[model samples]
Target chain A: MSDIKILQFAPFESFVSPTFWHKLAELKLDYDRLSDTKRSIFGYYTNRKASGCLLEVDYSAYNSEAQVPKFSHVAHGNIYNKNTIEEFKALDKTALLADEGKQLLDDMRSGRALSDASLLTRFFVLSFADLKCHSYYYWFAFPCPLTPALELLSPATKLKEIPNNGNYVEAISVLPAHAQNFFILHVNEQEKVCEALSLTAALSDFDEERAQHYIYCFADPSEYENPAWLMRNYVALLLQKCPTLIGKSLKFLGLRYDQQMHLDNSLIWEVRQAEACNYEHVQFVGWEANRNGKMGPRMANMRDSMDPAKLAENSV
Target chain B: MHIPNESKFRETGVLTPEEFVAAGDHLVHHCPTWQWAAGDESKTKTYLPKDKQFLITRNVACYRRCKQMEYVGEETLVEEESGDGGWVETHQLNDDGTSQLDDKICELTLDESKDEMFTIENGKRSPLRVVTTDDDNEDDDEAIDMDTFEESGMLELVDPAVATTTRKQDIETNPSNLASVVNASETTNSADSVLRTRTYDLHITYDKYYQTPRLWVVGYDEQRKPLTVEQMYEDVSQDHAKKTVTMESHPHLPGPNMASVHPCRHADIMKKIIQTVEEGGGQLGVHLYLIIFLKFVQTVIPTIEYDFTQNFNMS
Candidate 1:
């Protein structure tokens, strides 16, 4: 089994109840320490709506042209600020998409020619805390190049009706919109583990020396058991406290650690959606075995995942 | 001699061992003997008693008054006066500033003799030589070369008392010379005159991980012998020596062994030099690397003097 694990979550951004802060305090988390303002809330997205994510375009699994920057601050600095997010959102649908966004669409349409920088930037910008906190979910529908041979089933088919498949791996990135820190979580379905790694940098000055640094693994074994289950509960509780995440579109991110590639070129997957159902558990529909959409590999899987043990064993 | 405080030489310029030797030679030539000591064993000698000893003496010729009582024959003069009248005595004082009587002497005719002295007087106000016979002999028709003969009789000498007095006179004139010899030997053994200096051999290598030049102290000296651990304590400054001794490791050798090291500021200086060179697209060679290393090491090991210009077999 791979030593590292990853888990992905669709973030819900809203004003969390004061009781949630009290709960966070009980968990030894200082919620007030997240931001400078007292008005700030726990605005990060937890993976409550998504049943599980699938392994997509693992750079480690392929010999492809890839690069992952040592410092993520460079990408963070290039992204537009809060004011520009609105302007981009207000643009017409036919407007020229960003170079990265266009590259993402092109790669998804043809599961080949993946550009590392475009994928990283697309996912990073779409899940930006500023945009997610404002209930903007259009960017969440990020283009991903996953063409796995999944079984064909009707859209209305119950998630439990699908047969079991072997375990899969996925790359994920989770950001709390109200906080400066972010995480890249790699999910290993077979092991049922999530390797949560933290990436932090100074936001005020992107080029600050020692600005972007990474803590390889932030999750202790004790704290990270059944990572998918923990993520589900955390997200559910977060949404209950901050209801704004409901009906809000959010882009979820995935990451695959690559020794040879830079952070920008490393495998990154993005999925976009607005929570549309009241189901307590998250669900995902894989690309059917019919080779629907000519997807390369399934990047995410939605299934009945309210059960903690089943979620780890199920195809995601 | 005492080693100068290293702080005094902080920021002073540095040179290779060769350059150091050249400069040292210059200083030795210009300064008095007491100011600097040679670092090389071959260049210096231990001041010893035998080397400092020298000869001191005075030569004196004495003449006695003579009066003939009767003439017996054409070639002989019979003297009625006794006590060796009409004779001269010449005495040579010994190395110990003393003289002995009852010694054989050489006699010759005034015209035939090569003796340069006319008269010898032992006194405070006058030198022993009174006149020279060269002028008188130059005009004399009777001047003739004669074989000198040694004799123990029929020779007139100056007052007997003067002979003993002349020995004292020689001693008085030369007391300081003897005193100096004794002084030299005393100073050589005295603690006040101990020679103190510090020296080291430097080796430089490129550190791949740190991406900087690393300098290693391969050896150091205590009075020209490879220094022992105890002597190192005496040479280096107290605080630095303590730190250095603890952190030292053989930079170039493989073993569980350590040697004294100087760790302060070597990297900072090298980094700055590299940055400057990179800006100009300059490359560095072994010689240039050593030059830069020496220039900076002086600031750290200020108390220990070095001659950087000395040739090193880098290969």
Candidate 2:
């Protein structure tokens, strides 16, 4: 009982560049005037040289077609821009996250996540851009379903310690951009051959007898001792796709890299997932903590930087 | 000056847009912490490639105010000799054979000091730069008198080390018993001694007019709240804050104005460093321009702990 370790995932720390707010303000004033609709946005997290789980959004995040930087995986998200601060404050935060969680579960159950595993790591932002004062109030939520908590069957192992991990890392690197985020590494220890497969193909080729050979891998942005928050949903998707694997010990690879994109900090975990009483009533928990590490929205006062009158006053 | 036709960086002390890109690429390649951000697409400069608009490094910690670290160096001699007026010249590199450049900067500082006084008289909330001049040795007595008067006028002029020590003691004593117990354990552990210090997000963008890479800073306080322009000056070296640092909008990002280190003197300084490196029989490549730029920018904001690998030899 003392050996059992419940896997604690590191939550993401949202890093919104000033350019992100500026673009949001522009969208509010020009295009999104009085329209508090959910806008499609995307953020990228790098697996290379990260100190923690960091999800960064900049001006390019608004561009759906924006190229993800090398060694980075894109997480598709939506920005719900509120017209007024009052509206933003009055919005039910729990319901918002639950909606996103439901979408994730639906995607996983409908075989969408198996085909495109990126959907498993969805995030959203609720924001109110105060153009008058150039202040922006915002909160980010990386929707993750909380159910059937995974326990470690054994202690986390470094990727380098695993045999022929170099081959797995090499194969994973050459995968397509979309497939690179979440994939399966099929390793045959006797043959000493490892191959990377997409989640869809991996699911089809899933053999119960060779379960130990299948290493579910995700490009991890976390440099901490624990895996990142994205792994929670990744495991949930795996369970949804293959329900027969419930209560079975599985190998997961949190593929991390250094600045040189060398697989130095990658961690492998042997996890056992418990069966949830009801998968239909899944609970979601993922609202990002503010700077104070509290559950609240943060305000960025851009008056000195954005307001022309204030800029003129300061220059004088 | 050895002028190479292929590269004007060594000759002009200024970098062409291509040279700026090359230098930036070099910086990002070695110091992966510094990344090339595309910035706002609408505000992209035609000179720079869309994706390589600027170089940015965020969350660079500033553990203490500049005043706290001021007395630690040989500048204490300058502090003892020059009084209040000498504060402007204390941070100048003594070994750098750039007295002519120093004199020009001093003249500019003197002129700006007068402007600072006028702004204060007008009751305008201008960022303060304490300036007193010690050009004449005979006026040393008067300068010392002025220093005492200025110290009274500026509340922060009190000895910062003493102030910080007392503040730390207050923090240690004020917490509840349970909190103190936890803090005591944390102190013994040593690994959890993370201080809530001020941090700065630094950005380097190419200035078209000056033909030098301009450095911009956005600071946050211990609580991670954005630091006001006046609060930011506390971290910047008092000598350069007034003359070199200005509140300006970032060229790449449309946001509130950021504190930018004006590039007017950057080319002159870079040229001097290039000459020094050349005199030592080493050719200065444009790729190493940003490394040298960051080294000198350290003089301006000495407390911000941004990484510029210290392995390279300048001389």
Candidate 3:
């Protein structure tokens, strides 16, 4: 037991494009004046050609129906716009994370996550846009359940090292865009073939006799050695939906692709998750550390860029 | 802002929206790194196809500042020493002092160094010298007085408070000491050694008014933090940094204005390049428009290492 290593996951780096702030400003003045409500927003992550685990939000993030870019998966989230700086600073971060986490666990147990795997990648943003000054203060949180810690049974292996990986890659490529993010891969060792199945289909066809053939796969956005934080919730979702897999060693595939859509960098790990005696009370963690790595908010001073008067002054 | 009556890409070098799409598809086919993005659905242009609204390439690394490049020529070396604002400007003038399209090609052959600079090998060119001539009058609006010039120069100095804050943030964010390791190696002056650099997300959107493609840049610092407009200026060629690059709202996205290369002179430059090609007995196709556009935009941002696959020849 001492020889086994605990699995670690890289945190998501929030990339807020300038357009997001501009849109927020527009909303504050025109639509959401003095109303500090949670607005539905969505961010995206791409498994292809990423240097780090990133959650990117642009102007289109405000549009729920915006088309997801090629080779990217959408993570639906909400933005809590605070009216004042003091209100933003005074907000209870712990309770906020807990609320979001409880929502995620509920979704998992209710089969909502199974229907839409994107729910497993839930996130939220807390912000205060100083429209008058053109400065915005914000923080991001990628809520993840902390129960049922997964441990690596052995060192991770590259997908290329596994036999018949080409078949697995080929099958995964044909999956619909929605299923591409999270799915199950079944490898028939005797026949030397592989098949990709949607989570809903795989859950319906779960067989304990052939459980050994099932391999959980996810589109990993992290370029680091460790998997991305999204895997923690994914693991929780799997345990909540299928309790029989608890305490059983399973093969997990971190499906990463390059600019050319090649799976040369994909990694495979043998992981085991211990059962949580108290499943009702699952703890949640994951508030993104500020630029200082502390539990705080970061500020962006856009006065020079966003302020029309300042821009006019600079043009001279 | 004059719209061409007909598609005169091979003659006048002005491109219609259809021609822009054709050229963009050609660029994406050759250079897989460049992709067509639809941008905001609400902001889609009626002229462009829905999916092919604009071209974008992200995380293009700019390894070093333009000042760091080794200037080989005596004239450019003198220009470098004059001041930070003193960027080399080359004008290909005829023997009679007139700037003509035919004479520009002749002048390219006369100057061996200039010929070597424009030589495209494996889609890469040598560090560019800023080329501006009397014909580029559209940038006249960017001309600034001495007071504004001096104020911008002073703004380049690093503030002590900001420096300390950045250092503190670096220490706090990087718990594994990975950033320190990268910082240590970056201080070395060796050309081959790893250097902490800035990266840019380059976007090319077709301008209907000018009937040409305009370039926009969003840059990030070494820490991947969004760079301020002043910080982005460091990566741009000094000559064009003030004159050509202007902060404006993106056509397809509602952003607090991004730095864009004005498209006023794009048609004129394209026309000149087309004439030069025709005079050399080679016809310039509309499909190759973006390749040439990317090649010439290097003068505005010479350090950005964006990939533009050059399988074809340009004489």
Candidate 4:
């Protein structure tokens, strides 16, 4: 490969229809945050192979193909939201997928062709009942938990029902430098504030600066184990990926924070599973969606005569 | 099957103007539709579809607001005090040129013959770029790599496309592989095997309205934790709309041909909204007014049968 100075570098964010989970990462995602055309859900390439910190957007919840999302294929399985794949199937029964699903699976395992969900959906109607699968990972976007924000509030965590912008489920903060600094400062402030108000300090003659540093440094508590402190490091790692955001990611990160967020205090975020990494392969078995080594009762009734085209096991 | 009453408020219960505004503030940050708004307090309103107006009265400001707690993470660079020298922290540089694959995929366009397909010959999985040296010089060397993928169990997308070459004999002299004519539809095999990845999406949206402007309940966290008003604000502003909008979902609001009930038929939408509000330290209220909305809607159209499923699933 010829070497050219990379003028600008950025990490791209892609949200694909669960129907686009072709072999992990082989998706078609648009680079623009908001485009005139519909977001072409690109299959994900495993982070292992693609390398780098990944901002995963998992729509397995929509996999039921019955759970209608307000838009796109995310509404798949929804009693309401209509999807392109569903519309296509409804329009034509003998489409490419209807006849080719079984064969597609056969070649994928053999490493001949990559696997995709749209190609698989043609194996008759899909109901989670027909397949077996499990969650590999998840992201949570939530509100940034802060104590000051709670002052004039209720006691129940579920008191309020919805969150605003800053509130996210799960955000991976990655700015380690800032995180580390904040941690130290926060610890120092805690100690200093305590010492400042302590009546005991009047007699002990505590040195304000030294006392402040003690809680932060290893001056006291020889066996200090702080999980919250450790969690800070993870947040730092997530923040480190801030520059790579695109699409909804900008909404997830690039947005400014008026103040710092504390731990377990925000909305959970969308999660991405390592599909190929976990080696999870899902296929339909007689009107039921099935995964590796597991099966569920087909949602199809006997009178309907449901048969998901099956390829030879271990064919691909 | 529909009514267009933008000014219809307090059609049922007797909520004071303050309570109504406070409730709007809660839903603006807690409701999904309320997340996108423009302008500030005094006139906070969520931009939404004209039909879904029931959100206005959905909020029932509880006497008690939720509590919020959090674990503080790291801040910035640490300052040494023991007369120790200042130390520098290391950071991995952003992704670079070789990392972006625009030219790679674009060049794979079809020519005349279909034989010459697109394929990555080598370096498909580039090494993850990291910078450990505290030195300021070589910091711009980080590239997106596939290092931590194994542990997270999310590594499976980095494969080089390998195209098969086809030999051809043409009218001119020697034959060559082409991109055109290659059966875009025809498969070398009878068909292609498809692999579907299971996706799990947890959407936490805060539709906010800053009525009673001074304070408002945040929202219910998906993890069952409490979110604060500030946190709720942070979550909402993170979106493109960037405004404080009120929710108006009701049992039955006015809209197109006999639309379904707001809280019942659109159960997931409401559940997500309540969960968002609960996560934000906002109080969850019963949609008693939904029944009122239905009664009123029924009075307008006597034949409309209300299908109520008692919307549960809120925190």
Candidate 5:
């Protein structure tokens, strides 16, 4: 059986500071969090509904051919300034799709293809991170790719997400009309697990300077309370809350509670003060970066996890 | 010297271990060394002094001084020779306007925090920068870079946006021109989903010149599962492409809510999902069985439209 226990954020707070990084590798965990929200896991899917060109046909291969714009290849601005990326919004998709959807669009204008932007817009492209975020978002989608199969299923155009697609239909974008929206509950450790082990290395790159400006941009009243401290704390709290972050568990964050309300043991584990200097580098950080996909092997980078039995070892 | 609490004294730019020792020694050599005498209890430091008895505190840096300094609760008057050669006594007041006896140096002044002077650590460097990376640096996980002149060769640029911890400049500076350096930063606006599009298709044209239809596995997900692919064609909603079916008693399938997956066009779709996998990016499968199956289905099915969506509730 895989380790149901996930890594949490609470105990490892000290690792962010240089003083405790050396001790991080020594941490380990055997069980998961107690709540449904906090199980730790690393999941990957073959995204099919993504709307852009696959990397195979990207600019790398087509040097002399027509330079068509792709959604994934389209440039945009960041949240800080719209002054940048101002022009990308108005790109005409007609030119790029001329080769693929040209006949279809012309037919639509000539009563051939439907005028509905949704119909002409078939491919849905998004990155893995975006896909993960979209998992919780709502969208409108049609039932069938075939108008007849769809009409047979529903006379009028019905837009909604449905789940007949098996797990292997991985890595492709579905029609927007068929996109599903639901929240995967994560609490405790699951809420805080890095989508990949690479995230831990990214966490090290986060300094108070960048935290103040970009990543954890302040100014929102809800985030006024020690933005740095709050984010770190919530990350820990949420890690303890979600379970999907852990491998997969029904009870979130592996809660081990006593009858009197005191937790007999914690569900999440964190490696603070990694004894091995490897925790800060890209190799250690990029443990999964270049992999086509997959967390790869845990033993490659996973040094330690917290154990609920060692609650007494806390500094308090 | 007796540092005031009004401002945090940030000793900065601490160098090597040797420098730290030298700095401590310098402070001891320059300042007036006071013995720990049993004077007025509160005003004096009490301790066993050796032959070369130092100051009132073991910490060389944290101490008070004055020329024949008297521990008066009011303030310490430092007597020093002015440039004009007259003896001038200066009183250093505490934050609350109350003056206290601190330290007196032979030739010194306040605001002495030099960049090179302080040895306090900055928040950036870890006080314990243990070897986080192995010295071997035998980067095995990174891809084995393919040589140039390989089929249709061009360097694949890794987008910084994929970086989990992107800096503000990365997200802002040239977001619109992220991958398409050809596109200028000034050529875009909001509501654009192109940059927002996450999929990248590697379309290889199938021509008679090709002895065999070549297929290449590009990327996968975190699980190393193959990414979904399809026979690129018209959208599902077209008239000729539309396959109508009768509004028969329908077997309701799940939605994104239950399985919470890509709703449609997914390889998981009931009719073509198997063909999608069987083909597996190979033209053989798409051409051999999938295309045949699709063509057959289109020819036979007389499609109909019905609304069974409201027939059930979400789980």
Candidate 6:
């Protein structure tokens, strides 16, 4: 950086990128706008080194190589997206008696990678499940204490149906800035954009200039007590500040200086028990082109049989 | 992949010094390229090239047109404003005297090495000579201590053998070579105090349909932000200042390319000069062409404290 007296060209103008603007809009929505919103988190990525910001879910905690009785619902188990990790763990033992379930159980116990059907079935269930509905608990025999049973029953809502074999049941692999690690968030482009926009809209009040300045900084709501709810605000602030972030889009969204987990927004979920969630390291597992000229099955990271000639050469 | 070479001047023989001067005067009176510095110095704020320096005006890309907002980091700001008083600082070194190893990485890092190499090749042709100071007697005395810290006095160029041979050939072929003109000035200066006129190198060439005048700069003063068209036209004639000439940014040359412009009528004047030289079956090499251009430019910019000569090889 010697006095750069000599330049090839004279600078003409300075401009901002569209991604920065989108981030600004999102940050404003997250800071002073949206709360308890349906579209809470937009984009997510895993940081192996605990570069804390906001944690949506720590799948790694639940499923790691070091954990006993390795947990891999997506790669080995019968649990779908609709089934929470808690519900998946709590599945009835009787369900495993069926032939397909038995085969899945055998595969899981044998440490064999589950077929694509198992993973897709789970995703299909989660994708189709009506997450927006609320189930009310009745106090009396099938009814509220003060209301008639028939009156308590409300009009049935219509549920959209889709062929599981249709074009919808597709898994997308997300590669973050860290090349070694990736996340398999179950959603498509439309869902991601909608969630990103909603997050940005939450911080719409903040001016663009200020939004550009503090978009990467975590949102601090000291009064909120619940970690889950607090976690949502963190995600909201993060998503708004960095709308383009699939992972590491905000280059400066690094770990905070303070190690206090109570105030830190980076940690999404606390991994309290090892036995509760079984985790396994995936070598390679995703949809690949099959023999039938269609995307089929989950393939785990398995290396080919080593060649004798190559082994001999390595030994030399 | 390539266009065929065709230059009318190459077909004609080189122009003599007398014919070059006559052609230069024709363009100055009829088709001037410079304009007078408008109003006071503060109002214009254009860099008035002192002795031994010249303004090189050219159109460059506008930074204001960028739509994307960029956060210029501290590192970037420091690099941008490192030069003295914001006149982007660059040094003119004698040939083959750079810390080449230090810049090797920057050169290999990007594909911009072609232009970088070209600038180096260009630097080989005209190694910058010693720089002269315009400071008053008192300022010079005070600058003695400062001189030790700074690069003091004129840095002489190590002249190459090839340049001497070329100069001899130019003198032998053309009767009105710049060396003779410089000698004439030298003789006149000996009679009185040294004629300390600043020398500038002019470049007149066709760019597409237009001819442009690009002056070679040696250095600039403090606070010289002469990148814009308005800030560069202070030394031009008043009438010619209104003429629209785009200031282009040179990709490689740093301080030397400042306050320069690509005037529209440059090609027209150049064509006229070529025609004048070609009439006598005379050729036009770079040296003779420069001699002619300065002859006309001197009258147009009479008030400016500068002179034009081909004492050193210009890129």
Q: Where is model 6 more than 4 Å wrong at Cα?
A: A1-316, B1-4, B10-213, B216-231, B242-244, B251-259, B277-287, B297-302, B310-315
In candidate 2, residue B195 scores what lDDT? 22
How would you encode candidate 2's per-residue C-alpha lDDT over A58-164 as one tens digit per residue?
77888746556556788879999988767887788878988988888889888888887777778999988878866677789998877666878788899888766
Query: Relative to the unseen true structure, what is the C-alpha lDDT of residue B134 in candidate 2, on a scale of 0 to 100?
Result: 21
- Give the CAPRI class of candidate 1: incorrect
How does model 5 score on DockQ?
A: 0.01
- Report residue B14 deviation for candidate 1 (angstroms): 22
Over B1-315, each residue of candidate 6 has an lDDT whose tens digit, in order, gives: 222233333433233323333334443343333221111111222222211112222111121100000122354346544532221122122123454522432232222213353235224322111111122343334233222222111112111100011222223333333212111001111111111112232333222222233343221111111112221232344334334333343322221123334444444566676666667677555435555554555433332434232342222
Alpha carbon lDDT of residue A228, candidate 2? 84
| TM-score of model 2 (first chain only) | 0.94
lDDT of 5 by residue, A55-75 (tens): 111111111111212111111
Using Cα atoms, each model's DockQ against the true complex is 0.00, 0.09, 0.11, 0.02, 0.01, 0.01
lDDT winner among the candidates? 3
After superposing candidate 5, which stretches have Cα over 4 Å from the reference?
Answer: A1-37, A45-316, B1-234, B240-288, B294-315
Residue-wise lDDT of candidate 6 within A1-316, one digit each (tens)?
3421210101001111111122222333443232211111111222221211121211111122211110111112211221232332243312222323334334334423111212111101011111222111000000000100011112211111222212211211121122111112122333332111122232434343333322222222111111111222123223323343322212111111122222123212111111111113111111111111122211111001022342232121
Error of 6 at B54 (Å): 14
Clashes of each: 56, 4, 0, 168, 154, 72
lDDT per model, in order?
Answer: 0.25, 0.71, 0.72, 0.21, 0.18, 0.24
Give candidate 4's error at residue A302 in angstroms.
Answer: 21
Could you tell me the lDDT of residue A306 within candidate 1? 19
TM-score of chain A of each: 0.20, 0.94, 0.96, 0.17, 0.13, 0.17
Candidate 4, residue B104: the lDDT equals 24
**Residue B154 CA error for candidate 5 (Å)?**
40
C-alpha positional error of residue B130 in candidate 1 after TM-score superposition, expressed in Å: 64
Output the number of the TM-score-best candidate. Answer: 3
Give candidate 4 regions above 4 Å deviation. A1-185, A189-191, A194-316, B1-6, B10-315
